[model samples]
Target: MLTNVATVIWDGLNPFEFGAACEAFGLDRSNDGHENIPVPAFAVCSPTPGAVRTSMGFSIEAPHDLGRVAEADLIVIPAMGHTTPETLPDGVAEVLWAGYDRGARLLTLCSGAFALGAAGLLDGHECTTHWMYTDKLQRLHPEAKVIPEVLYVDAGQIVTSAGTAAGLDASLHIWRQEYGAAVAAQIARRMVVPPLRDGGQAQFIDRAVVEPDTETFGSLLEWIVENLHEELDVPTLARRSLMSPRTFARRFRAETGATPHAWITGQRVLRAEQLLERSDRSVEWIAAETGFGNAATLRHHFTRVRGLSPQAYRKRFAC
Candidate 1:
């Protein structure tokens, strides 16, 4: 049902993020054998409708203005340099509000979430920006729940993603929702990217270890990741850390921003994803290897976390 798409550009645009929106929705792939699925009519619009300089020192012309957003079913806002709520252009906030009021979905990439926050669209929503700006975003929009760890947050009408390449993840999620996994997979194949990524921005965060001080917990985390096939309950992990269960649980949450059980489950799921993508193992074998015990348990947690069953995921991502 999503047919009309518009990508809004502005001064200080990041070309890669803007190009992500164009590649996702603007390309005409009707002759690629998926004829029944219709490609959306796409447009690049700017507030000034002229030469817009990018952050990388090049200029690209936008032929349309804010008027194009009015007819769009979805509007994508790419990353811009100035991310403060007060520094947005003159009428960009009004135009965004108008589109939201009329029921158009808004997808923002990286710092573009700042524009939505400035327009008050992110007032009560769970949103995100690039990891580097998440603190500033939270500081600026105190009302918005800014989660810096995830690739994207889908708050119904407003979808926000982290840095440049994560825009592809969010865009493919939209396609997977509107169409199905097959269509999304085909598009991802054409783009030479994975249809689903396992973990989140937590995997990309820089965690420096300062010898014996940080080595205890950091080493424990690495051990858990390596030995996901073992029994990794809180008590076992606590014993391994030489702390009481109660103390270990609190310290684990403080260190990882997640409970021990949640962290272990996430690691198990990530291991399962790697096995599914690389090997020809059966689901039951993979479940046991990842410490899920059985196929049903694996299916339950995998479907809840990845939005697809093990078989379906293997069918799409297996090499």
Candidate 2:
């Protein structure tokens, strides 16, 4: 059903976000002898239908008017380097709502979700934006469930992404739904980016996993990392931290933003990714080493967080 894609451009646009949507759909990949790749009809439209200024102090001509966007099968709103959309065409919100009403898929990259939020499209839906402005987005539209620190959120028809290249991940996710995994993988290979980065990945992985607050629980957290191969249940951790289970759980969530089990699982999966890339060990060995204990358990968690099983990830990413 995704046939035509229309992207809305405006002044103060971030070229990277704008181009992510354009590159995903606009290019005629099938014409390049890639017969399996289906190219959707793509066009760039503007509120004013003329010179659109960019964040880099330059301008690009937008040839089409926004009038046609309401009929598009997919509508894109890229980040404008700000949360609030400014100087949009007349009835832009209405146009978006019309598309939604008719069953068109709407995607917003980074701060572009703000536009949908203004239109009340995000109400009662779990959506996301760039991590830096997630709090502000939540404040502006209190009814929308804004998930922060993840790559993207797919609330059925409405897809929202984090900053920069996360847009490609969201676009590929949509393509994977419309087309097949083979087609999505081919496009990802052509684009020279990793295919199938899951939406739930930590937006800031290293900091979110490795570098927790050092002032409190410094040595305790370090011990957990060192002993990822050992049992890391809450009771064990609570005993080690010298606090009761309930108090430890509350304190852990207060400081780390994730429960102890969730935090420990993320670290183990991170280690599993590294081992899968750098070492030639078997999946069972890696699983045991990362404290998952068995292949099935490791596969379940790894695929949930990474969107690729350990064996598949090794095939694609192993060096």
Candidate 3:
């Protein structure tokens, strides 16, 4: 039902985030066997309807003014240079509130969540922003629950995402929900990006820097990823790492921001998703291949992680 989309542009906007919105909603891909799907009427709107300067020292012009948002079924706020609540442009908050109050979904990419917070729209909702700004967003809006490590948080009518490329993940999530995984995959194919990604922003966060000469566990992590089908419990991994089980667990958590089991399971699920999408294999085969032991166990884990059964995922996304 998301047939109309509008993106709001402001001065000093980040071009990458703005382009993410446009790539997700603005392109007309009807020629790609997607005629059954509704092509959203997309527009770019500005506060004053003129050339808007970007953070990269360039300017881009939007075709419409703030009024365009009033007619959209969804409104997108791209990340801008000024993320603080006190620096919002005139009437931007009102426009966001009006669109949300009228039953339209509001999406923010990265620091754009700050604008939503400034509008008081995120006060009681779960939201997120770029990791660099997560602390500031929470400090500015104590009432909002800020989840810093996820790709995006979908809180009913308001959707917020983490930094940069996570915007694509969030946008594909919306597409998958509105249409289906097939449509999202098709769009992703056109964009030359993965249709689905596992885990969260925590994987991208920088860990404590070790000295260049210090011995690390990089090879162990790579081996785990390459052999997700094997048994990789804490004791086995600890033995492989040449450390005590307790010490290995502590060090893994510190370096990865996720426990060993959680990281391994996430990688298995990611592999299962790829297999489900790319091959015509049975659930039982995929379960065993991904180290889930059996179909029921795979279903339990897949459902808990992806909110969809393995069969349903294959049906929606199989190539």
Candidate 4:
């Protein structure tokens, strides 16, 4: 349903993330070889029709103004690097509130969540921010329930993402809900990023079953991810972690919030989804590589988790 999007900009915006928003929603594809593709498109900038400086010591100019947001389908707020809590300019909050009241979708990227919080849009909403600012957002807005573990939280009309790259995942999720997985996948493919990153997965971090003081589970988790093709059960995983099965399961759940079986199945399903969309391999081949043992097992679990057969998913999301 989103045919247009608007990005709000300010003096100290993070250019990379601001550009990510533009890249996802603002880019014109009329003649970019996607001439026949239905792009979920376009941006209208904030307050002015000129350039804005970024936190990265660079600048980008907008071709439009905040009025553009008034008429758009969605409005995006990207992170601003302003140093003081009270430094936000006069009327910025009003602009945001006005947009939301007018029934436009309001989304915030990372620290940009603060702006939404300030306007009371996030009040009583389950939301998240860059980990570093989770406490700050909470301290600043007591009514907002801040969730730290999620990559993004979609409270229907109000969406907020954790940090820089997480904005990609959030944007794609919106695309999926509005346009379907096919459009989301196509947009992701054009960006050369993963089509789907579950909001529940831990952000890029180590997953080793180690104590807080000396554990280095990141590398170990990477090894597990790479070797997902091997048969892995609790006993085998416990052996690798040098713990008893019960102890390992307890610790793994504590660390990842998922039981070992759930984690493995989720990862395998995620891998299968990627393969289904990105490769021409047979179900048997993908099943073997993703540790589902055989095509039948893969099909069963894939359909169970995704509510679609592998062929159906491929037909919808694959190029």
Task: Name the weakest run of 10 consecutive residues (lDDT summed) in model 1.
Answer: 207-216
Give each model a TM-score: 0.69, 0.66, 0.74, 0.68
Best model number under TM-score: 3
Q: Residue-pair clashes per candidate, as listed?
A: 0, 0, 0, 4
The 0-to-1 C-alpha lDDT of every candidate, in the order given, reads 0.85, 0.82, 0.85, 0.77
TM-score of 4: 0.68
lDDT ranking of the models: 3, 1, 2, 4
The alpha-carbon lDDT assigned to residue 83 of candidate 3 equals: 59
Q: Give one digit per residue, the lDDT tens place, for model 3 in 1-319.
A: 7899999988989999999999999888888777755689999999888899999999999889998899998999999854565778888888998999899999999898988998889999999998888999999999999998888999989999998888998999888767656677779998998777555777566742232221467788779878888999999999998899999988787666578888888778877877888888899999999999999999999888777899987877676
| Cα TM-score of candidate 3 | 0.74
Winner on TM-score between 1 and 4 is: 1
Compute the lDDT of residue 99 as modeled in candidate 1. 87
What is candidate 4's lDDT per residue for 34-84, written digit by digit as tens?
A: 663455457647565677877888778877776666777688989875223
Q: Give one digit per residue, the lDDT tens place, for model 2 in 1-319.
A: 5689999888888888898998899888877668867778888888788899999999988898888897699999999755444544467788898899999999999889888987789999999887778889999889999988678888888999887788998998787556545566678988999665422435264354343455777798779889999999999999988899999988787666578888889878878877887789999999999999999999999999767899987886664
318: Cα error in model 2, Å: 27
